[model samples]
Every structure is written in structure tokens, then in C-alpha cells.
Target: MKEYIERVTDGEDLSLSEARTASSLVFEAATEAQIGALLSALRAKGETEAEIAGFAQGMRDAARTIDPDRRPLVDTCGTGGDGHDTINVSTTSAFVVAGAGVPVAKHGNYSVSSSS
Candidate 1:
């Protein structure tokens, strides 16, 4: 993890596996300061698509998911948060999907102001 941190601090991107490890560490039962350092360091180095995907994959794996045997298994997921330009397309799409007799499982979150 420290090596990954060093790579990122040196403006080098982490490999997919390293990113995955770093992502897991963020959610570990550790101190907030430790988490903050990880986040802050990553933020300072700017984000990479591979890193972001690895992080999201880690978080998704940790999340509670529905059983695969559930009926009406339709997904209309969204990334959420359109800043001040949200047009509710995702919400509208959910309604449309449900109206078509498909069980729409929409997942999203409130808009957050992330630092650049």
C-alpha cells in the first residue's frame, strides 16, 4: 500500500491490482485519518479510469446485493448526481422501464460536489 502511495505521489498511476488493494484499504475498519490520506493522495494525483473502476468494483463487492433468483430481475442503474444540470432522465427512465412491465431496480445517490 505504501508503495502504491509512492507511485501515485510520483504522478505514476497504479496498476489494476494495486488499485484494487488500495480500494479495499479505504473501506477497512481503520482510522479516518488513514482513509483520508489515501483519498487525499489519490486526489492530489488526479484520478485514472482504471483506478476508479477498481475502487468501484471493490465497493460493489462489499455492497449487499439481491439474490440472483429474484423475479423481475431488471436493472436500470445510474451513476447519479448531475450537479445543477440534472434533468431527471434516470428517474424518468425508471418509470418508463417499470411501465413496460419490467422490474426496474434503479440505484443512485444525491449529487455530491467532488473536488477536482
Candidate 2:
């Protein structure tokens, strides 16, 4: 799971400051036993949209980035699904938005599991 997290954040070029902030969050959120249980529960039951959205908001609040003067910005994200049979419509949507003159920040991951 740590490896998965590292891969997901690879492009962020996380600084020592960022690492410290994440470490603080982890320390504050769970004891060792609770952390283990949380991971197990998520793996078993899958994460809810609210949980994922909350995490995204938390990361945005914690990290530093260009403000773009409060201009409209859009992010396109996909919740990976099972099976290789599905084509990436979400990935295509990002390009379509960019082609339509909207600024988009797209995020994606390589399929690592058969269920992804």
C-alpha cells in the first residue's frame, strides 16, 4: 500500500515539507492498530466516494501550488474499474475538455490489478 501511494504521488515531487505534513496527518489520524484495521476495511469494502473526495480535498488543502489567480480550473479523475474490456472514456474526456479550450488537470494510473 505504501508502494501504491508512492507511485500515485510520484509526479508531485514531494518535498521534505510535504512529507512532514503527510507524516503529521498519518500520526494524527490513527494508532498502529487502527491504521491496520482501516486498511483492511478499505481493502475489503472498497472506498466510498465521500472518502476519496475528502482525501482529495485534504491533499489540496495541504499542498502548495500555483493559485492561477482564482481562474476556473477543472480536474478529471477516474476510479479504476475491473476488466481490460473497458476502454478509457474518462481519459478521452480530459482531452476533449482541453480541445474545447478548458484547462484540465488529469490524473490516471496504469492498471495494476485485474480489478483495475
Model 1 error, position 89 (Å): 19
Mark the regions of model 1 whose C-alpha exceeds 4 Å error after superposition: 71-107, 110-116
Model 2 bad stretches (over 4 Å) = 1-70, 112-116
Pairs that clash in candidate 2:
none
- Candidate 1 has its poorest 10 consecutive residues by lDDT at 107-116
Global Cα RMSD, each model: 6.4, 11.8
- Per-residue alpha-carbon lDDT of candidate 1 for residues 1-116, written as tens digits (9 for 90 to 100): 56666778788987777788777777775467767766778899998989898888878767767665768767665544556555657777888888888776777675453211
Q: What is the C-alpha lDDT of each candidate?
A: 0.73, 0.55
Give the lDDT of residue 72 in candidate 1.
75
Please provide TM-scores, in order, for all candidate models, with all chains considered together: 0.55, 0.35
